[model samples]
Target: MQQIKIKQYGNAQEAFAFEEQEKPVPIDSQLLIQVEGFGLNYADVMARNGLYKDAPKIPFVPGYEVVGKVIQCGKGTPPDFIGERVVAFTRFGGYAEQAVGDFRAARIIGDRISGGEACALATQYCTAYYMTDYISNLHEGETALIHACAGGVGTALSQLCRRKGVTVIGLCGSEEKVAFLEAMGVDFIINYKKNNYKKLIENRLGKRKIDYIFNTVAGNSFKEDMKLLNYGGKIYCFGGAARSGKKDHILNDLAFLLKTGFVSPLFMMMKSHGVIGVNMLRIADNHTAVIGKCLGELHQLWLQGEIKPVVGATFQASQIGEAHQLLESGKSMGKIYVYW
Candidate 1:
């Protein structure tokens, strides 16, 4: 088997090494997946640069979602799973041509959904569904602010909001992303690069405030998002993309804390605002059943055409480093897929 591993902590191109490894065998409740493809996530970029705390130690494979067929199954697994086309959430090791997945975290994907869409299930769409559908219960007529609104999970949120009749204000850093969100039927698009998104959104709605905020860009963006929230509004903070992906961002880290000051429980209670953080890896570790339910729901939506995954780019497994580069560049509009 061939796999790409994070060789050293640095830039994407310099961090990966492709090598041969013995094929893995499934154990109790696990399946051996013959990897057809996988999705490139921003966390993979952070992992390559040694920034993501959840990433495994160096010289480890870094991948979350994988799409493929089950070639073998373990003792506790059902015989029906073998040869089934499925999307599996391997917390890591999806970068390999073959990987192992606990059967509980693997779901049978319908023929209606493409491999790219299957990849979206484990991380991007599942996260969006878990937050909005299962947790937030985003209702009709609500307004949402989605930062990085053209990225993988951002696109999923846009699709989910549009289907639910929730007005979405999509925020991006590039004009290209703005155009993509516009086509996705976002109520508003703001290029945060040239415009003050917080001020622009304020100007448009006047006194009206956002009901939901899906934020990954933390720091100043986090502070600003709190003020934008309306009464009963909730902000789901999943990541900190605002820190420019530099090697030594210690100074930037300090600046991030300075800009985003500490807030006591009293302030949140007084304002009637809420902030929830999500680290999907943590969820997968502690709440496997929850992830299963989320993936099942997303699969049904994809089948019904209520939601879809956008494949911004696809790279062969050998080009793993380039795939990481594209995802981190912020140029890729949707999920990036890498196939064996």
Candidate 2:
């Protein structure tokens, strides 16, 4: 098997080292996955920087999702799953030509879904769907604020939100991404680079407050969104990209924390707006069943033509560094991946 290891944390080009290794054998309840590809997420970049506490030690494979076929099964694994292509929510070790994962973390996919498309269903779409379809209770004619709206999870949430007839205010950092959101038919698309998005949100909704807010970029993003949430409204934060960028990004996060401290628990209770944080790694580690269930639900949505996974670009496994750099640049408009 060929694997990419995070040799050390620094620049993306210098962070990962590719090497040939013995093909891993699955242990009890694990499946040997012949990976066709693995999804590259912003989280992968943060892990490379030693910023994500959940990440493994240095010199580790830092992928969370792989799209591939189960070529072998270990003890306690179901017998019928030996020959299916699936999307796997691996806790780690996904950046390889072949890898081992617990059977519970993978779900079967139809033959029609491409590897890149299947990759999105496992981590990105599941997080988006779980938040909007299951938790937010978003309704028809409601208003949603989707930050980083051209992102992987953001695109999935936009699709689901549109399907439910919710009006979406999409925020992106680039003109290109704003155009991408415009093509998705967001009610309003604002380029955060040129416009004051907090003020944009205020100007767009003079009186009506946001019914749901999806934030992955934290810091002032969450603070500002909190002020605009409607009574009984919900806010879901998954990542803090504001705190995870390259070059002095950690400094930026510390600055924000120093200035704002934390959102007052008392204020949250008094305002009657619910705030929730999601860490998919925790879900993958403890609630593996939920991981499988989310993938199954997303597969159904794909079958019904209700959702489509967007792959902005695909890279070869050899180009892992470039893939990470692209994700770090925040220039890609949708999910990015590297395949064998």
Candidate 3:
């Protein structure tokens, strides 16, 4: 097997290496997949930074989701599974020429969707779908405020919300992303760089505050964005890209603790709002069956053309470093890919 493994804990430019290793063989009830393509995620970047909770030790392969064909089957494995195409979320060891996973964890990809598209949706869209439908409880015609509105989960939520007739107000980091969100049918876009997002929310939406807020970036913006939630609305906290950089201030630490603790949900109570925190990895860990169901629904939505995954770009296996660089630079809007 050829895999991209992290050799050190530091920046992407310094850590990852491409090397050859023995391919994995299936265990009891496990299926070995011949890699086609895999999606790059922020969790992969966090793992490289040594920030991801419970990340495997240094010198480990990091990839969450992949789409591939089953090449070999283990003893007692179902006979129908051989030669089937599937998508799955592996805790690690997915960025390689071959990997192994369980049958229940794998969702069969139907013939209507392409392999590349299925790979893109396997993790990103599944996360968004579960959060939007199960956690946020988003209703038709409800308004949604999406942070990181041009990234992988954001783009998926944009299309899904559009399909469900939910108006989306996209908040992104740049003007180019503003244009990108516009093309994706975003009802309004706020450039968090040059403008005031709080005022943009008030000015554009009037008194009907945001019905649901999907926040991937947390920090001062997380605190500020909470004010936009309407009565009985829910805010789903999924990621914390806002505090990505190291900080040293005494008050900053206190503030972050306060915000993550009581302040957020306290405000929710004051206004009859709801605050929900989601760690998809944790959800996948504890509620495996639920996560599998969500993946199945997302695949069906893709087959029906109700949602489309945004693939920023694809690279060959040797281009692993370049793929990580693109993710670190934040130049790409959606999931980056590495193919064998």
Candidate 4:
């Protein structure tokens, strides 16, 4: 079997290496999967760079979600699962021609859903569903401000919001991305680099404020984002990419604290405002069943044409480094798929 593995902790392109390995066999509780497609996630980037605290040790296969068919079943496994097409959230080892996991961990995708959509539901889309539905308590008709509106989670959120009739103000870094969001059915599009997004929303909404803010770009963006929140609005913080890769990242946090003063969470308490930090990986660890339920729900929506996966690009398993490069370049929109 051929697999992609992280050679060590460093640059992703340098760290990822393709190699041959012995085919894996399943135990009584596990199922052997013939790899079809796997979703590339930010976690995989972190795993390659050694930034993820929970990342597996070096010289390990690195993929988080996979969509494929069950080629072999373990002892005592159900006869029905044989040759069934499914998607599974494997903590590791999905970037290969074959992978293995427990049968119960896999979700069988119906014929209505394509392999690409099933792979998406296993990761990025699942994260967005859990973040909005459970962590943020987003409701229909509520206005949402989503950062990175053309990215994987952003696109998924837009689709989910469109289904629920939630008014979404999508924020992006470029004009091309703004156009992309407009095509995705977003209510408003702001290119943060060219215009002041905070001012644009303020001017249009007229102090209405965003009812919910789903943010993946924290750092300098957080301060401005918080200002756009209505008195009772909730901000779901997911990532600090905007503040990362800097020598004084901690200092930036201190500056934000000083600027906001005691009125951060204190204001949330006094005026019903809320800031909920969300890490989907953590949620998946403690609430696997909850996450699984969200995945199932999103999968059903995809089947019904209420939602869709935007696969911006697909690369072969041998081109794992190229996939990582595209992710780092920050140019691609939607989910990137790696197929064997």
Candidate 5:
């Protein structure tokens, strides 16, 4: 088996090294997938830079999702799963030619779906589904704000909100993304780089307060979102893209934390505002079944044409460095996939 390993923590080009390794065998309820390709998440970039706390130590493979055929199944797994084409959620090890994942986290895909689309269903769409359907209740006539609204999860969230008849206020960093979201039928698009998103959203909404906010850029944005939230509104914090590009030092980490500021439980209670933090890795660790349910539901939605996965770009496994660089650049509009 061949895999890309993180040799060191720094820029993408200097951090990765290709190497040959023995193929891993699945154990317990796990399945070994002959990986066709894998998807890139922002966490992979954070892992490469040594910013993700839960990432494995140096020399480890960094990937969250894989689309491939099931070649082998472990104990308690069904033999019928063998030879099935599926998308699976890998804890790490997904950067290799083969990877193992809990059978419960794997879902079969039809020939109609491309590998890049299947990869989106694993981590990105599942995360969006878990937040929108599992954790929060979205209703018709409500308004929601989505950060990074042109990326993988953001695209998924936007479509999901649309299905529920909720108006979407999408925030992006570039005009290209604004056009992309506009084509996707986003109710409103704000280029945060060119204008104050807070004022723009306020001007657009007038007296209507946001009912929900899907925030990936944590920092001063959290405080800003709180101000725009309605009494019953809730904000979901999932990523810290704002922390990227900081100096590799403890002081820099602390400074980023300070910028996010602190929240008081008493204040939130009195104001009737709620803050929810989502770390899918932790959820997968303690409640694997929840992830399985989310994946299954998302798969059904895709099959029904209720949601579409956006493939921003594709790269060969040898171009892993390029993939990381593009994802880190935040210029890619949708999911980026690296194929073996």
Candidate 6:
């Protein structure tokens, strides 16, 4: 089997090395898959930069999702699952021609879906579904704000919100993203790079306030979102893209944390505001069943045409460095993946 390994922590070109290794066998409740491709996420960039705390040590594989066919099934897994074409969430080790993952984290898909589309469902769409449908009770006529609203999970979140009849305020860093959101029928689009998003949102809402906020940039935006939140509104923090790119710098990390500031539960209780943080990796660790459920629901949604996963770009296996560079640049509009 051939796989891409993180040889060191630094830039994408210097960090990865290709190597041959023995094909891994599935253990209890696991499935061995012949991977077609794997998707890239912002966390992969963080991992390459040695910034993600949960990432495996050096020389480890660093992918989270893959679209593949199950070639073998392990003990406690259903035998019928063999030969199924599925999209699966891998803890790691997905950047290879073959991989193994827990059967609970895999869901069957049809032949019509492309590898990029299937890869989108495994991690990005599942994360969106888990946050919108499983955890929150979103209602019709409500308003929600999505930060980084042109990316994979952001696109999924916008579509899910639209299905619920909620108005979406999509925030992005570029005009191209604003146009993309417009085509997707986002209720409002803000280019934070050119305009002050806080002011724009306030001017548009007038007396009303945001009902829910899906915030991924968590530095100063945390305090800003709190101010714009309506009574009883909740803010979901998922990523910290606002953090400086100085890896392993204690002062820089502290600066980012300080900018996020402090939150008092007492104040939130009095104001009826709520703050919730989401780390999908943590959820996968503690609640494995939830991953399966979310994957199943997202698959159904895609089949019904209720949601669409955009494939920003697809790269060859040899172009792994280019894929990482695009993801790190944050200029890619949707899901980016590399085919084996």
Give the best candidate by lDDT.
5
Question: Model 5, range 7-40, lDDT digits (tens) per residue?
Answer: 9999999999999999999999999999999999
Of 4 and 5, the candidate ahead on TM-score is 5
Model 2, position 301, has a per-residue lDDT of: 90
Using alpha carbons, what is the TM-score of model 6?
Answer: 0.98
What value does the lDDT take at residue 261 in candidate 1? 61
Writing each residue's lDDT as its tens digit, candidate 6 over 227-253 gives 899899999999888873777688888
lDDT for each of the candidates?
0.86, 0.85, 0.79, 0.78, 0.91, 0.90
Question: Against the hidden true structure, what lDDT does model 1 obtain?
Answer: 0.86
Residue 214 C-alpha lDDT in model 3 = 85
List CA RMSD, all candidates.
1.4, 1.7, 2.4, 3.0, 1.0, 1.0
Error in Å for residue 153 of model 6:
0.7
lDDT of 3 by residue, 168-255 (tens): 9998888888888888889989988889888878987776488888888777776677678888887888887654544435675566
Q: Backbone clashes per model, in order?
A: 0, 0, 0, 0, 0, 0
| Predicted candidate 4 versus true structure: per-residue lDDT over 1-340, tens digit per residue | 8888899866656887788898899888577888887888876776676656577788888877888888998897777878988887777888888888656557788566656667778777887887777555566778988998898988988887777778989988877787788788888988888999888889999774788888886666777877888878888777655543433345765764454334455667886888877776676566666666877787778777888899888888777888888886778899898887
- The TM-scores of all predictions, comma-separated, are 0.96, 0.95, 0.92, 0.89, 0.98, 0.98
TM-score of 4: 0.89
Residue 25 lDDT (model 2): 88
User: What does the lDDT read for residue 179 in candidate 6?
Assistant: 91
TM-score of structure candidate 5: 0.98
lDDT (0-100) at residue 7 of candidate 5?
Answer: 94
The TM-score measured for candidate 2 stands at 0.95
